[model samples]
Target: MELVSGLFLSKRIVYKNGTPVPLSVITKSFEELFNIKLGDCYKKHESVISRKPTKLTEFLDELRKFIIEERENKGYR
Candidate 1:
């Protein structure tokens, strides 16, 4: 997923999580993987918001295609 304006740019399916995951741990993992200090992802940003539904739907479709391809390669689908 892309990081736009210091926020994860994705279409969140679950609006709220009953078992909340630790965001700090996630960000730390991302920072380590990307080799970049995502300090902004840690802070609050009022300006950052989700993309439009049309664009988000496109992204979701692309992601679904990728997942299908991977599963097919593994002979699972």
Candidate 2:
């Protein structure tokens, strides 16, 4: 029997005030804020409907924290 799986993929990103915020960042933020994680989705590199993730959720939290930490560590102001 074929097992069911998922593939989650998304476009580059969404903009707010013309800021090129990566989609991953936005998703990461949501995943952190509400502790929300989704499972696998059927996604492929080329194809609109072929966007999905294998795991519904991610273990990473504190999306903002991570961003801050990265900036600070790099001494980017």
Best by TM-score: 1
Segments of candidate 2 deviating more than 4 angstroms: 1-17, 39-48, 51-77
For model 1, residues 1-77, the per-residue Cα lDDT tens digits are 33432333333322365343344555666779989776755352222335565654454578789999999999994
What is the overall TM-score of model 1 with all chains considered together?
0.41
Predicted structure 2: clash tally: 23
Give the least accurate 10-residue stretch of model 1, judged by summed lDDT.
5-14
Candidate 1 runs further than 4 Å off:
1-19, 42-49, 57-61, 73-76
TM-score of each: 0.41, 0.28
- State the lDDT at 70 in candidate 1: 97
CA lDDT scores, all candidates in order: 0.52, 0.41
Write one digit per residue (lDDT tens) for candidate 2, span 1-77.
Answer: 00111112233344666555544455455557778663322231133233345432222325557888999999998
Task: Report clashes for each candidate as comma-separated counts.
Answer: 0, 23
